[model samples]
Target: MKSAMMEREGFAALVLRLRSEGISDINLLTAVEQTPRSRFVAHHLAEHAYSSRTIPIECGSFLEGADLAVRLLHRLRIGAGQRVLEIGTGSGFMTAVLGRIVERVISVERYKTLVEEAQTRLDQFSIRNVILRQGDGSNGLPGEGTFDRIIATAAFPAIPKTFTEQLVHNGILMCPVMVDDERCVMVRLTRTGSRFEREDLFEVPYLPLTPHIASYL
Candidate 1:
């Protein structure tokens, strides 16, 4: 077992790696420093928690590594008091980061198990700014209204119309879009009046965004 000192050093090293990857946002680095990746990772993988790599969670969903998390947050450029919508709660690590930086986060996950687990993790941190729901994230959260920023942790072949429609003018929607059957790219879409402009940021591997809820399994 790694000592507390060792764990801290590990995370510190991870931060250096994140900086090397071009994630220079101090706020994001601070959030990562405050949040312990082990708490959101699988028990079996706890020892590797501080490593900058994705870890599988329940229902085949994966918690994005510190690098991707920082990159996404960097692209969204979320600010305090901004209403944000997160499309995949997964292990709730990113949700926690969003909660620390934004006014509120409405996170939707298709897996009931993941929703429940994520809620539990966030509650442990006393993070009260998150609203967790089990539903089809591809549809976006309608009753909650539009958001200043929308981030989908899953990959979609194309940005869903509902997500674009739910964004206020000038709002940003960041998600991984499928480039082909086996590859995906990170895309940022800024709403401008009745239309949205797309910018491809980087290539990444993420689980496919699906419409069906995995409630029964």
Candidate 2:
């Protein structure tokens, strides 16, 4: 009953909100609009799923923002057959979108239930090639292939050491950073030698890093 209603709500969201907001990427907007945000949310919050505003979800929350995932991906200048590593898998919304656009993705989440449920939702869309793992997102998935692009859904106080260690040279790291009160910004980092070049982009709000989960390593 609720699932059916939420599914319908997601379609409505695509038409009313996401499309009109300049989220004109054919594949991106289509993937988000088609993907049921409600299914990824808790049952209690299902009714609010379609709103353009953010909705709370398990562990933390997920919201429809400026399409930071989409915008950051564009900043990467990703090319086909590129491998991506996504931290903070969240509702797997970003993961599914990346799967459609990239050669492959390895997405990690701290919560087991979120990972399981997100996997189910993504599978419903026939999204293959997104490998989901349960682990600490702050620490990049060990032995996961070198990523051409890395994006984190969680806000970074400063760039995490693990994520930077895993990137291949010339790769891009895109995520939100806390600069100061009312000064939060999403930025892009490109590695050059041992240093990183940071480019500030737009404002974004995101879940903070988590220190604990059963899968923490």
lDDT of each: 0.85, 0.72
lDDT of 1 by residue, 122-177 (tens): 88989898899888888888778899999998899888888888999989999899
What CA root-mean-square deviation does each model show from the true structure?
Answer: 1.6, 3.7
lDDT, model 1 = 0.85
Clashes of 1: 0
**In angstroms, what RMSD does candidate 1 have relative to the true structure?**
1.6
| Model 2, global lDDT | 0.72
TM-score for all models, in order of appearance = 0.93, 0.77
Compute the lDDT of residue 69 as modeled in candidate 1. Answer: 76
Residue 37, model 1: lDDT of 83
For candidate 2, write residues 1-217 as lDDT tens digits: 8578657765665455545555556656565556666666667876666654576666555744424445555566665688999888778877877787789988888788778888998889898889998877777777766788998877878777887888888888887777874456777889876788889888777756775566522
